[model samples]
Target: MTSKARLIYNPVSGREQMPKNVADILDVLEQAGYEASAFRTTPEKMSAQNEATRAAKEGFDLIVAAGGDGTINEVVNGIAFLEDRPKMAIIPAGTTNDYARALGIPRDNIPDAAKIILKNKTRKMDIGKACFNKKTQYFVNIAASGSLTELTYGVPYEIKSALGYAAYLIKGAEMLPHLTENEMRLTYDDGVYEGKLSMFLLGMTNSIGGFEQIMPDAQLSDGLFQLIVVKPSDPGNLLKLMALALNGKHVDDPNIIYTKTRSLKAELIGKSEGKDLPVNLDGEIGGYCPVSFDNLKQHIEFYVGC
Candidate 1:
């Protein structure tokens, strides 16, 4: 029997060339013996999830998420809950394809990416399930929260479309002076840590927001997340830590807390009492904090190149 492939792509993601390349991508899959079809995501929230779920139910042999982290996260959440899920593929057609980079997938090369998909090598990977504000959502890469980190959502659509990832850096630099420490109580695996922190990042993969060294030790199938918490410090000190993080050496700093764990809980305290800490998942605004995360070990089988 011929295998069915469902291609779900975000038309405007990254360079917005997927619409033009759809024919080529489909042709590649067809040449590789797949009965391929494509689905362009709608403007509605969770539309990718809905489409992915429908594809899963209909039993597509392979489900392709052709966009950035947000689109991949949506597709993961869409089909993760099902006991019968299909093999997954990704096309890194986004401004910052951090997840793809970590997996050694070609980001700027479309035909090469399609060729990699045809290779069909796959691995079992972990998935993160976060419960916040009485709602549960899933993530494939990283989940983060802190001051200045919320700027990913503030970059105007026009700016993002025109300047791509540089827009994030420009906005981040502009918001540096506004960085606020988050006072919180965090519990992870039989230990409690309370402090005023600059940022808290939970990661399942080494590459985060295009920074490969941010969580260099993270392993996708490890069933544990690499957590990094930056303690409250002066702006200069914070800048130094940021620089060190670029080389994955920030863990040696006294103000930096790093560990690997299966679960964690974060609660707001001190200055964060009445405010909701903005949370980001896979480069998109997830929600507010007062959240908990659990790793679903080897939850999904994802295809990648050899």
Candidate 2:
């Protein structure tokens, strides 16, 4: 009997190379003794999530997500809730493969990534779940809201696939001037905090948008999220914090609030009520505010290089 692997990829992801690399991907999997099949996501019909779920139900021994952070999020969400989920693998074919970066996967080389998968080592990792206005989504990397965070999703798909990571910088610059401050009360495992903040991020892994030190102490299997909140500040102060974040020194700054928590409940206050504050999960638009976040520890096993 042969083990089966399902490769679910987004053709438009990253530099649009997955479609061209399909044969090489399958060859690599075959050499590793797995019978592999492929699925290309289509905007008109099936999504990455749907294909992932179908592959899992059909009992694929491995489910490989070949795309960027958004594609990984969709595949993870599709199977994370299933009782018998397949082990996950990555191709890192996206602009910002944050999850892949966290795992030290080769982001630009698909063949090397396939070889890593062939090595077959596995590690248990956490997943982040957010619920808002009766909507729920699962994220394997990070979940955040406020300020210019929504720029991740705002960058048009074409520009992102064309220019890769640089597209985010362009969009971020365009969005920075319009950033909003939200007044909210955050209730976590230990206590409650009420204030106005430019952004708040719940991270399961330290690698986020290329800022590896943003949550330097994050532990993926710990069942807790490293929450970082940026207090309201002038543009100048915010720029300073951005520099501090790159070095993981912002946690001690008075304008920054950092802690570890397993669960968090955020409710809008003051003028933020009824407002459509953007929420992002694993680099995609999740929903609005008044959300609860829970860390699901050791939620999935992945084929990783150790």
Candidate 3:
């Protein structure tokens, strides 16, 4: 039986040169014996999740996402709802292919990635579900609250286009001076902790913001979620933590606290009591603080090169 490959790609990703690579990808897939078809994504059209869901329902053997983290998030969301999901692949066609990096997919070359996808070694990985208000969804990587969340919301779309991943650093630096500490009460399977914290990040994957290693101990298939909490500290301590994170050494830093849990609940406890502090899920800001996270064990499967 010939495997069918459906590609959902963002045309505007990767310096607007992503479409240029499609023909080559199609050629490679065809050579590998896949009945390949490509679809261009638009803002108003069916989302990546919708596309993936449709493909899986229509019995595509493989569904490939060819954008960045946001695109992968959608595709994962689509597959999460399927009873029998198709093996998913990544083409790493975005500016910061964070999910691709976490999966050890090569971004510099396209043909190699296509070849790997054709081979199709599927691995079952844990999925994280975040619920706030009436919105509840699944994330394959990190869900964060506080400063990083605010930064994600505050950064303009234009800046993201102009600077790529560096836009996050610039926006984060600018917001640092004015960032407010979050007074939150956190409850997890292990225990409960309450305090004023600079930021709270829960990771199912090792990295965040494309390159920052916020959760150095995170494993995608570990079946547990890793939580990193940054307490309210002196600016110097925060700076040191930031530096350590860039080097993937934040787990060892004294000021940063790391823990693993199957589930966690965060409630805001202060003057901004009723107000919702922005919470970022997989680099997209939408939910508020006081969010609950639960691990969905082996909930999703991916075609990984590693």
TM-score on alpha carbons, each prediction: 0.94, 0.93, 0.90
Answer with 1 or 2, whichever has the higher lDDT.
2
Residue range 136-188, candidate 2, lDDT tens digits: 88998888888757655678878866776677667766666677798999999
lDDT of each model, Cα atoms only? 0.84, 0.85, 0.78
Worst 10 residues of 2 by lDDT: 168-177
- Local accuracy of candidate 3 as per-residue lDDT tens digits, 1-306: 898988888887766666888888888778767899988888974478788888889998877888877788888887876788877778886666777788878877766776776675778889898888787878888888876566555667678767877887777677677767777899987888788888888888776766647777778887799988887777666666667778778777766779999999999897657866878877787577678888988877777878
Task: Give the TM-score ranking, best first.
Answer: 1, 2, 3
Q: What is candidate 1's TM-score against the reference? A: 0.94
Largest lDDT belongs to which candidate?
Answer: 2
Candidate 2 has which clashing residue pairs, if any? none
| Candidate 1 per-residue lDDT over residues 1-306, each given as its tens digit | 999999999998766888888888898889878899999999998999999999999989888899887898899989999999888888988877877887778988877787787676889889999899878888988888888566556787688767866776677667677888878988987578898887888999988766778897888898999988888887777767766867999888999889999998988998678796778888787778889999999999887764
